[model samples]
Target: MTEVDIATKAPESDAQQDSSTNEPTDASQQMGEHEHCVTDRPTPAGQGSTGEIIKLNGVDVYISKPTDYPHTPSRLLLLLTGGTGIKSTNNQIQADIYASEGFLVLMPDLFGGEKAPGGKDTYFADNSTSLLEQVKLKAVEIAKSFMIDMWLARITEAKIMPILHKVIEAAHEEYADAIKYGEGIYAVGYCVGGRYVLLLAKGSHEAGNDEESGMVKAGPYIKAGALAHAASVTPDDFKNLQAPLSLVCVENDALFTDEVRKVGEDIMTQDNLEHEVQVYPGVPHGFAVTGQYQESAIMDAQVTAYEQMLAWVKDH
Candidate 1:
């Protein structure tokens, strides 16, 4: 395991009005303008770290930098939170782990600043809510009405891709200096976010392969990607993937089954694209994030996944 220095700092607060937060006055007007606010922030208590939050394009991104590094970081990892949204403690733990590994980590709010659709309380339900629960909350009627695949389809079409574009642009602008020397840009997604990571890799290639679609591309910047216990990815999703991809799957996961993994693998193989699929035995869907159950096993899997992700990014 990589050693990380832990530091504490008082949170900084800054107030800035971003046009993106304003209500649109006319149809001709763009929905939102680019704006960002930086606030000194610390990692969740017990994590022993400090960083900042950047409000960009109307979304809050939690950024953490590695401490006691001998040299500047050469890579950036954009972490996408699962369905429960960015406020979950599980996400924070993963963020701290990634930051400790010496890469600049930025986590974007997947809900795009909205109150999660079905109601935040009903969705999250409890601190122990697993990745599957967040995506399929029993208390939320809407979640029950739609199947996971359909829900992911709608989310990918409506929110995930668009928000990803905004976040990428904001990261480029906000971290321009630090990114200058960075070797490459990478992404890691959990649960629903995992599907988005696949979409980004696919979309990047799609924008180049198909001109008529007019889709925004994440290809030029993101060179590698990984997904942990990802939900709702299908064979069709991998048709245009252009980057090296690694998938960390759990054997006990109900959402991403063996068949689902096969679908992605088959597609990548046919295309002769670079990809890897590692299935860890006896763990659930949110094994990498939530630490409520199967503590020892889950923790082990999380570490292995993190190491795999870092190695994949560097190798690519």
Candidate 2:
């Protein structure tokens, strides 16, 4: 599509004010317009360690930096939190793990401080010897906890994407030593966050492809992207996917079913987009972030997914 077409179709600016917090959300604010405020934020007691919370362009971000690295970390990872929101203990722990692996991980609060109902304890699988039964039990719990439509209405692509764009722009400026604009930046998303990652990748490609008259100079918003058990993804998302993409799915996820996944994969293959998909057996949606990690099966699948994502990001 032409630059004009892309510009016209681009999402309108996000809501002028956040509905949940009534805070001004001026996503276009210049990075240098305000100084960043870094505060020692603590996660719930005994949950795990999360990096400090920093404000960038009006967004609250949880950033974890790897320590004791021989050299400065070159990779910048934008982690999108699931519907559990950014403050979930599991989400923070996940960020910490990524940081330990030498990634500068930034997880923004997609929900502007409004609490999400389900959290780390959402997994409802009991000692069901049958994997199918376990998946069903987990699905029921997730459906009960998450009001998907309401949350989707509140955090539409139009509402969240601009905020994310500004967050990234500010991140490039804030972490200039470690991350250069359009270089070495990657994203990983879970559940709702996964869908956002796909949008980010699509946006990066559409904006970058139009070199002469693009909105900004043609460059990637994110170098590559990965997702686990992404919710609300459609086959259309794969039509013109640009960046290298990877997906980790559970075999029995209601959100990301086998048929839907196949359709998307077909589209990506037809477009010849560089991408990979791996579906682990006998787990439900949210297996990566919200799974019952105490279970050996769930823990193994989650670890494998994380490793797959890390390998893909590094390879790309």
> Which tens-of-lDDT digit does each residue in 32-96 have in candidate 2?
01100001112334667658888987889998888853275457889998766666666878888
Best by TM-score: 2
Model 2 segments more than 4 A misplaced: 1-47, 69-71, 119-146, 203-219, 290-292
lDDT of each: 0.59, 0.64
The digit string of per-residue lDDT tens for model 1 on 109-176 reads 87765433322121112335454653443334343324333444556545566566677777777766
TM-scores of all candidate predictions against the true structure? 0.68, 0.72
Q: What does the lDDT come to for candidate 1?
A: 0.59
Error of 2 at 221 (Å): 1.5
Runs in model 1 deviating more than 4 A are 1-45, 68-71, 115-154, 203-221
